[model samples]
Target: MVRERSSHWNQKCRCLLLGLTVILILGAVVVFAAVILAGRRDPPAELPQWKGRGSTANLEEIILGRCFIYTRIVNPELRKDCLKIWETFKNAFVSKNPCNITEQDYQPLMELAAHPIQCNKTLLWSKTNELAHKYTKVQGNLLTLEDTLLGYMADGLTWCGSPSSSETNYQSCPHWRECANNPVSIYWKMASKTFAEAVCGVVHVMLNGSINHAFGNSSIFGSVEVHHLNPKKVHLMKIWVMHNIGEQPSDSCSGSSIKELKSIIEGKNITFSCEDDHRAVQLIQCVGQPEEPACRVCRTEF
Candidate 1:
């Protein structure tokens, strides 16, 4: 009887210990779940419209101040017409969906700011905005689209209109791909067409040689500008395939895209010539690396 009672007591103790162990494990699990839940955080709220949006004053400064000063210097008659320009610009895109604005919407503003393109001084570029701008500035004779009045006014500014209101949406604007007829892309297309139509004598074209395709068909220079070049007006097209100073370039005047450009120019019956490592482009590259051996011999190409 004593041995049986001892055995029964042992069994009771084992059951109690098992129950305690189960209870402890459940408690640990609850604590772990609570810690995980406590560590999580809520996402931040979207900012209020007033806090996120930009002001019209910034646009006014860009147009009335920088654009006005440049316009006045170029043509003094426009000195007092800065406000008029601003008004015209606002009317072009205001009260309309930004993505819905087309190139024709800017026609009124373009008409107001239009100037005759100088002969033989037109510079067409693709993927060479910085170098081309620098080259034009240094030469002081060649004119890119940016040198024109309309281009100067809206070079890098972004403004959009609303359907419910007549105010500008400075907070967010449609990207270029968001719509086919967006304001910015269409404006450049129109400008490029105008610029190309004015090409005369020996026209200069700047292209980047480091990219996969130096003369992409979709580029403004290729699609719009090149298409507008009148064989009768433009006698010769000089293509400058620019490359980095030290690095060996992937594409050249003989590259497939460039050959395609040549074929296109030839199809128009305009004379075509190309230069690899064009001296002018190298000189622009040399501006930052004047100590380089290649830059030491850089000369102006007329």
Candidate 2:
């Protein structure tokens, strides 16, 4: 009997050890999984680069630059006024031109007014250093509107008379100020695309990388290189200027396909000197613009 009791005790001890071993294994597995996930999280900063080149098929950029609004839009009432202006102008068609009112959908003016608000046009450009540090493309969106007109103008819902790309202007009945028959119009789809956010220095988000829509040609693009920060996100380093007429695209847009802007940087670095410093350069892609050169600055390998 004593021997039998001894055997039972041995069996119970073995089961306890086995349970502890299973628990330890599960704990080790959970710890490993957590480390791998943490390693894959997104980085908190963005890198910089210049923009150049573009495609003709996509609409041309209308108002290029930042829209600087000087006001306190934090208040709920202020926000309401901003939205009201947009709602009114978005439907601001003369009601005479059914096509302009119905088909265009104020897309033209909305495209033009997508910049951050500034008192004057010059403020939108190169800052004199004092304001440059305060204003950034990422933080620009947070600045609120002091006026209603700008919000109306930028909103996709607001209409800007009739925007037409065709040289042929349509004559309308009795004149009514600037409103006469046709408002100085822009071809919304033909002009340029406005982004969810406005960028600085150069208009980078308007490139093929961010929008991803196919242009007149069957070609499609993925990412534009600004830096190695985010491989999945588009960097505004490469730009497409767009050819409105006889101008041919810059030589960079020629043969082969590009998945990202890396293809351009991969080539031999073209080195040059500037006012007080030496620089390296290379051509990426050219979409063609009226006069702007397609080349810009980028990172180079030594």
Best by TM-score: 1
C-alpha RMSD in Å of predicted model 1 compared with the true structure: 17.2
> lDDT of all predictions, in order shown?
0.80, 0.30
What are the per-residue Cα lDDT tens digits for candidate 1 across 1-302? 99999999999999999999999999999999998887885654332243222434488678777666676686565534677878887887777766677777887777776667767898889998999999999889988888877777778776666665677777666666667666567777877776777668889899999898999999888889999998998889999999877877889998999999999999999999999988866887988888888878658999
The TM-scores, one per candidate, come to 0.75, 0.22
**Candidate 1, residue 159: how far the Cα is off, in Å:** 1.6
Q: What is the lDDT of residue 179 in candidate 1?
A: 71
Residues 113-174, candidate 2: write the lDDT tens digits: 34443221111111112222233222344222212234323333222222322111223321
Off by over 4 Å in 1: 1-57, 75-80, 291-293, 296-302
Q: Please tell me which predicted candidate would have the highest lDDT against the true structure.
A: 1
Poorest 10 consecutive residues by lDDT, candidate 1: 46-55
Once model 2 is optimally superposed onto the true structure by TM-score, how far is the C-alpha of residue 194 displaced, in angstroms?
Answer: 8.5
In candidate 1, which residue pairs clash? none
